[model samples]
Target: MTARALATTCAATACAATALSLLLTSCGIIPGLGGGDAPAEDPAPSAAPDAAAAHRELPLTRQGRMFIDGGGDVLLEITFRKLQHNGEYLMIEVDHDLLEPLRASGTSTDRTAPIRLLDPVTGEVLRAIKDPGTGLSLGTYFTEGSDVTPVHQGIPTTFRRYFPAPSHDAGHLTFTGSGLGHVPGLPVEYVDEFTPSPEPNIHDYFNEYAEKTADELPGELFYPEEVPEPGLDASAFRQGIESFVDTAESSTTRSGDRETISLHADRMFDVNADEPTAEAAETIRRTALTLRENPGPGEITVVGHTDGSGSDAHNRELSLRRAEAVRDLLAEELGEDFTLTAEGRGSEEPVAEEGGEDDEQARARNRRVEFVFTVPDTAAGAGGEGLDSAARHVAAPAVFFEDLEPVATAEHGDVELNVYPLVRDGAYLFQMVGFGNSTLSDLEADLGAGEEVAGGPDRVTEGTLGGFRLLEPDGPTRYVVRLVTEDGYEDFADEVLTLSPGDEYLALAVFPAPGPDVASMTLHAGAFGEIPDVPIR
Candidate 1:
C-alpha cells in the first residue's frame, strides 16, 4: 500500500476561563447558565409527550465509554448531538465531557481537530473541509488567543464541525476519531438551511485575537455571508477496502474498483529456481476458480517479485521467468475469454523491512506473485462455495459455531484477552475485546511481538491488535482488521490501551463483513493464539 501523510493545519490553544453549563435537550443542549449575550428563550412545549419522549430516546451508536487515558482513568464521554444537513455541507455537532480534571499544561496543540465519517457499505470516508484560502479545517477549536480551552471537570463543551455532505443515500455513517473510537449506525438529521448557534463560537474568539494582533495576523476574520462551499469531486475521491487472507500462501485485497490477489512465490517454486513445484498447480487451480467466481473486466496483470538476497540482475531475470510460467498456466486454466499479461519487479517493492531482528520472516513476505484486475460491481461480498480441501480460496462465510460457545479466552503473562462475539454492522464486522491485567502492577503488552501461526506474518503495530486477523471457521480465508487511512494518517480498528492492574479495557476492531449468510469466525488474536467458534451477530 502507498503511504500518504494526512496534513492537519489546525492546533489547540490555552483554556479560557469562560464556558457554558447547559441543560440537556432532545437534539441539543438547552442554552442556560453560560456567558453569552441574552440567552435564547427555551422552546415552548408542543403538547405531544410521546413525540417528545421518542425524540429524547434517540440513541448514540457507540461501544463502551472512551477514556482519555488507556488505564481506565480520565473518562471522556462523547455524544453525537446532531448531524444537520446544510447546503453543500453536513454540519456535525459533538459534545465532549471530560469527567476528570486536566491540567493546563496537559493541553496539546496537536490534540483538537479533524473528525471523519465513514460509510461502510459504500466504502467512502468523509473528512472535514478546509477553507481553500487559509487551509484551516472548518471546525470549532474552543480557542482562547493561541491555545484551546481544555475541557474542565464536569463541564460539557459542544463542538461544531462541517464536512462535505455525502453524495450517497446512506441514512447512517460511522463516526470515528482519536478521541472517539468507531461509532457505527449514527442517524443523520436533515435540515433545509444552516443556522449558527448562540453559543460563544471559535470564530468570535479568533476574530478578537486577529484584531488585537493585527500586526501579526492580517486578514478578513469571519465570513458568515460567504461561507466556502466546494462542489463534490466524486471522481477524485479514493475508496478504501479490507484485506482478506485465505491461507498463508495467498491473500486478497480490494481497493476502490480493483482487486489484487497475492500468492506466495516460495510456496510455488524451489529456492533459486523458476520451475513450479508439484504442489503449485493446485494453488493455481484454486486461484482460477476464485477468478471465475468473482469475474471482472479488463486484462489481468501477473506481476512477480523476489526477496533481496541474490544479485539484482539474476533475480530480475528469474522473477520474469516465473511470471511467464504462472501466466502460461493461468491461461490454460482460464479459457480464451479473458486477457492476461505478465511483468516482473524483483525486490523493487517490499511490504516489510529487511534488516531487522526478524529479517528472514520479512524476506519471506517480500517474495510473492500478484494478479491485479478490476472487480465487477456485483462481486463484492458475493458468496461462493470454496473447495473442501485444506487449500480453499473462496470468499464464502462460515455459518456454524454459534451454539458452541462460552466465547474464548486466552492469556500471555499478566495480560488476559477475552474476545466476545462478533457484531455485523452493514459492510463491517465489530469485535469487542475485553483485556484484563491480573498483576498488582501495570503490565505492558506488545501485540506486534506475538508469534506467527505457522510462520505467517507478524503483527503490524505494537500495543494495538493491528496485526491480528479473523479467519473463516470452515475455510482458510482470513479477514484482516480494516485500516482507516486519510492523507498521511492511518490506524487499525483497535486502540493502544494501557492495562492497569486489576483494571479492564474493552477495545474494538472493525473488519470487512463477510456474506450475511455467515455466522461464525476464528480470531487470530496476537499473543493469545487462535480463538475459534466466535459467533457473529
Candidate 2:
C-alpha cells in the first residue's frame, strides 16, 4: 500500500528468481517460511517446568516401531525418540515424518498412536494403556462419527505418558512391540542423563497455513491440498460418565443340596496378587453381616477354587492364597467368636460347563471363594436347613461386563444406541453399548477407535489398544482402552463399526477417569446430543 515499497517490490519482481521470488520470506517477518539454524520455541507449555523440577530423563532404550494405529496399517520407518521420566511417569517424543518417504502429502488425516512396552528378556504383556483423550473434538459435527481430525501427518504430537515405567532399576528394560515393526528389536541406546535441548519443531499443517496478510503464496504452499474423505458420522462416540450407581447385582448363584456362596476371586484381587482390592471391602462387609445372622456357630468353610487353564501346581497355589485371604477377612471380622477353616481345591468342583475353558466368563466360575455352611446335628432338623437367600453373594463380574443396563438412551439419524457406563475401577471407567441401525444405507458408527482414514499401506503392527494413554487420577493408574485380548474382549480403539441397514452391533468405549472428586462427566459424541449424569458404579 506504500508507494515507495510498491516501486521497490515491482523492481524486485523483475528479478524475482534471483532475490525475492520464493526465498525472501524466510525471516520471522513471516514465521515458518524458510529453514533456519535458530533454535525453535517450545510449542508445548507443559514442558516448561522450573529447572529445580524433579523431572528425570529416561531413554526409550529401543527403537520404537511406528504404526499408524499400533498395527501395521502403515509402518512409518521412523526413528526412536527419547523419553523423560518422573517417578513412575514417562514422557516420550518421536520424530514426526523426518524422512521424506513418510511425509504427509494429499490430504490431512488424524491418527491414534498405540504403544506397548515389553520385557526385553521375556516379552510378556504387563499392561495396556488406552487413548485417554475422549476422541471427541469440542467443535463441529464433521468430526463426530469419525474420531479422525485434521492433522499434519509430518508433525510430531509428542505422545505423553504412553505407559508408566515398571520400576526404578528395571534396566536392560527392553521395550519391544509387534505393531508395524517389520524389523525385530528397535536399536537401544543408553544415555546417562536426559538433557533436553530444544530442537527445530516442524510447523504442522495448521500452523503452516499460508496467510493473505503477507501476500504470500496460497494455502497449498504449506497446508495439504485435499481434505480427507469423510467416513461415518463420529458424533456418537461417548465422552465421560456423569454419575454412577450399581443397577445390576455384582453376582448371582444357583442353589444345590448345600447353600454355597461363591465370591469371584479375580475382582477381589489384582492379577496374581493375594490382597483384596479396595472395592472388595464392600463385599466383605456384606458377607460378614450375612454370616453373623446365621443361627448358632455353624461350621463355616472358606474354600478357594481355580480354573483348569493353569498348571496344577500354579492353580493350587493360587487357590490357597485366595483362601488365606478370605480367612484373614473372617478372622478380622468375627475375632474368636466363630470357627472358620480355609481350604484350597484347585481346578476341582468347577460350576461352569466350560469351567476348564480359557474363556474369562467360563473361567470366572472357577476363580471363586466359596462359603459353605454346615449345621450341627444337635439341633432338630438342623441338617435340613440350608443357606438363606442372604447367604448367596451378588456381584457383577469386575473386569468383564455383560448385559449391563443402559444408563441413558440416544439415537442419531438411524443409529439407536443404549449406553452402559458399567463400572469404574481404579483408573478408568468401562462402558458397553449396543447399536441398532434400521436405515437402508450403510451406517458407520465411530466407536472412537482406530484411524478414520488409512495413512499408508506398507505397515502393520498391533494397532489395537494393547497399549496407550495412561489416566492417573488420584487412585490407581488405569489405561483408557488398554486391553489384552482375552476370550471375546478387545480394545475399543481397534474397531470401526459398519452397520448395514437393519443391522445391529455392540461396542465398548473406555475413557479416562474424571478423578475421584468428580462423580460424573457428560458423554459427548461428534454432532449428536450429549448424555449427562451417566452413572459410574
Candidate 3:
C-alpha cells in the first residue's frame, strides 16, 4: 500500500491495527514477517511514519488518547494538559496507559525496546524512555532494530504527575538530543509523555499552564501598544498645575525671614488709637496666609518705632500699642502657627533727623511697626543652607557693654578732677564726656587739701595718680577714676576700658585755662591706654 493509504488505514483503526499487526505477524498470517515482506511487494513497511508529520498530528491539549512509537510492538499512550517547547527538551503529561503497552509487550527473554519523543522542526531527538524491569526502552533509533537491543543505555525516562490544584507540581522528563547522530524514527514527534495527576482541578491546571506559557514566551509576542498624545490642551493643563505650586511657594513667607508687610500710625494716636486700618487688616490677612502656607520654627519680631516729637515715655507706650495691634491681628488670623513678639524702641532710633520740614515724613516713617523674623542660633546652625548672607551678618559679634565707673582722682593748678578708667573689649566703646572747669582752691577745700580717700567704697578703689598704686585698703575690683577740673576748665570722662587681673598703671588729670582762656585737660590711664582728645570750654 502507498504511504498515504497505509497512514489512512492506520488512523481509521489504530487500536485494531496495533492488535492485528501483533497477532498476524506472530501467528504467521504472512510467513516470515520479521525477515521481510514478500510476494507482490508486501507493503514496504509503510516507510516508518515520518516523526515530523506524527508530531503535527498530536493535539496541543490531551483531551483524547495519543499513540506514540514505543519501539517494536509496544506503543505509548499519552494524556496531557499542554505540551511545552523548552528549547532543548519538550515536556508533556502522559497517562499510566502510556506505559502499559510497553510493559506488557516485552518478554523475559527479549532486550528492552526504546521509546522516543522527537522534534521534527529541528530534526532533533529530544527524549527517550525505557523500562528496566521489562527490558524495554524507548528513544531515537539508529537502525531498524535498534530498540530491540538488551542494553538500552542512551535512553532516559522520568515519570511525574502534573496536578491542577492548590499545589501545582508537574513531572519532568529530559533527554539530551546531542548524542543522537541524526533525528529519531519515532512515529510521534515532540510528544508530551508525562501524565497529569487527576486530583488537581482542571481549571487550575490550565490556568497554571497559561501563566507559565506567558512567562516563557518571547517578549515581542504580547507587548502593549504605544499611547497617542492628548493634544495642545493637555500641555496647558499641566502648566496650570505647575503655576499653582509656584504661586503657593512664593506667597508663603518663611517663619524667620524678615516680614515684608509693616504697620504705621499717626502721632495723634500716640497715647491710644493705634487700631487696625482696613488696609492694614488686609495686609495682615495676606501675611497670615503666607505664613500658614510655609510653616517653620521661627519667631517674628514686631518692632514699633516713634518720632521724637513726644516725650520718651508717651512715645514708647504708643509704639507698643501699634506693635500690639499688628500682633493681635496676626495672632487672630494665623493662630498657633507662628511665634510673635511686640517691642517698642520709642524715640531712640529716628528714621529721619530732628528739626526739619520733612518732620511729617519722619513722623510717618517712625510711626511704624516693622516685623523682623529671627531664627534661633541653634536652628540657624541646623538649617545653614537656608540662611542668607545678611541673616549670617546679624549673628556676628557686635557690641554689648554692662558695668562702667570711675577709677581714680587728682588735682593740679586750678583743676581738681575725677578720672574714670574706661574698660572695653568689643569693637568700639562709647562715652559721653562732661566738662566743668572749677578752681583748684574749690577742689582743695572740698577735699581738705590732699587728704587721701581712705579705704574707698565697695568694688571701687581710690588711688594716687602719680604713684599708680591703689590705697592699701583698695583691692582688685574694677574702678572708674573720676576727675573734676576747676572753674573755667572743662570736665572730662573716659570711654569704657578693660583692666587685666593684675597690672599697675598711672593716669594724669591736667587742668588748663577755662573758657576762651579755658585750657583743655589731657587725662591718661597708664597701662590700659589714654582717653582720646577732648575739647574743654
Candidate 4:
C-alpha cells in the first residue's frame, strides 16, 4: 500500500476498533486481541452468567495506587497490578478496588474516556482494539454496568487491559481514563508463558485470595514450626562456614571463600509476580555499588524463593521468575566482572520451620532472594571467608599503646616517638606509634605531609620511597596503613592530636600489605622525619 493509503487505513482501523475495544477494555477476553483463545475465567459481569455472585478477584500485581475522581474521593485503586506482553500486544492485569458510595443506592460514576495508554517517554498515544472472544475475566459483587459504578467495600474490581503492545524497548506508560499510575519496564514472557493454573484449581486459586489462607503473606505473620536456632553454633564452623550477619529483612553469611547475602523476597517482590518495585530496585542498585567498591573474584548465584504457598509447580515458577528478575537487574549494574546464575528454590528448603497453615508470618520470612558469592578457591578459603569483608568496604580498628614495642625512636624537640608493628598477617597490616612528651611544653608535631623526611639523614630515607612512601606502596597493592580507631578509620592527616608534659599517646595506622615477606618498613615520624627501617617483629 502507498504511504497515504496505509495512513488512511490505519486511522480507519483504529476508529473501527475503538468501540469494541471499550467493551473489552474493562479486562479479560479482549475479543480478538487475546492471541485468539478466550480464557476459562468468566468475562465482564454483564457478559458472564452469574450476577448473584459477581466476584472480581484481586490479581498478583496490585500496588495499591489510588485513582481519585475530580474530588479527592478515590474512585478506583490498583493493587497487585502487573503488566506483561506477547510479541504482538501488551497484557496488563490489575487488582482493583472500586470504592463507590453503595451499589444499592443505584449510584453511578463516569469513565471520562476509554482507558488511554500513553507512552510516558515519547508522549505517543498507542491505540488499542477489542480482542473479542479471547482472554479470561471473572467478577464477584462487581457490576460492569457503566465504566464507573463501583461496588461497595470488600468486593474487588479487577480486569485485564490490552494495548497494541508498545515497541519491545518501551518501558513505562501512564494511563488516564481507566488504569492510573506508571507501568514498569515489564519484561515480556511468551503468550503461552506457561499453561495457566490447572482447570480445577482456577476458582480455588482466585477465590483463595478472597479468603486469606496463603502463607505467601508478606509483613504478615506465618510462624515457623521449627524453632529458629538460638544462635549459630561451633558445629556450623566445621561445615566450612565462617561468620554471618543477619537481620529480619536480609542476611550475609560466609563459608570457605564464599559469602552469601540474602534479601527477603518480600523486600524485593510482591505476591506471585517477578517484576521488582522501584523500592526493591533501588536496594539492588545499592548492593551493586557496594560490590563495585569491594570487587571480589567470585561466581555469583542469585537464588529466588517463595514461602509454603500454592502448588509445587506454581511456587517453583514464581520463585524462578523472581530470581530471573533480580538477576537481570544485578547484571545491568555489576557489569561483566562477575558471572551470575539465577535459580529458584520453590518453598523447598525453607530457612524457617516446616510451617503449616498457622505460619503466616514465618512464611513471610521465607520469601527472599539470595546472592551467593564464591571466590577463588585458596584466596577466599584462607580466612573465615568474608569475616573481614564489607559489602566492599573496610574500616580501621582501635590502637592501644600499652601492648606495642618500640621498633624505632625519634625525638622532635620535647616529644619522643616510638613505632610498633602490632599485626602483620594476610592482606591487613597494623602499626601503633606512641608519643611521649619529656619537656615542660606541650608538643604538636607540624608533620604537615611530613616534609622533614627530605631533610632527615640519607640513612633514614635510603632504599625507601621517602617519608611515608612506604605507607603508600606501588604496583599490585593490598590494604595500606592509615590511622584507625574504634570510631572508624581515618587519614593520619586528619588527626589533631596533642601531647602534654609527661603524657604518652598512641596512634594507630592500618595498611593493605601485599605479602608476608616484609620484615621492616620506614615509619615517618611527625617532625622527627623518617625512622629508618622500622622492624615488623
lDDT of each: 0.53, 0.37, 0.28, 0.40
lDDT of 2 by residue, 226-290 (tens): 11122422212211111111101122221112335567777777776778888667666666666
Candidate 1 at 241: error in angstroms? Answer: 4.1
What lDDT, from 0 to 1, does candidate 3 have?
Answer: 0.28
Off by over 4 Å in 2: 1-75, 84-88, 98-113, 120-163, 174-178, 181-193, 199-537
- Ranking of all candidate structures by their lDDT, best first: 1, 4, 2, 3
Instruction: Give me the runs in candidate 4 sitting further than 4 Å from their true place.
Output: 1-241, 354-358, 376-537
* Candidate 1 lDDT over residue span 25-141, tens digit each: 001100011221222232222111121211121234221222222233334455566777664677766555644454322212221223457666566667665445444444554
Looking at candidate 2, what is the lDDT of residue 324? Answer: 86
Q: Where does candidate 3 stray beyond 4 Å?
A: 1-261, 266-272, 293-297, 375-537
Q: Per-prediction count of colliding residue pairs?
A: 14, 42, 55, 45
Instruction: Give the C-alpha lDDT of model 4.
Output: 0.40
**Better TM-score candidate (3, 4):** 4
Arranged by TM-score with the best first, the candidates are 1, 4, 2, 3
Best-matching candidate per lDDT: 1
> By the lDDT metric, which is better: model 2 or model 4?
4
Local accuracy of candidate 3 as per-residue lDDT tens digits, 163-260 = 11101111221111111111111122333333332332221232333344223422221111111112211111000000000011111111222333
C-alpha lDDT of residue 245 in model 4: 34
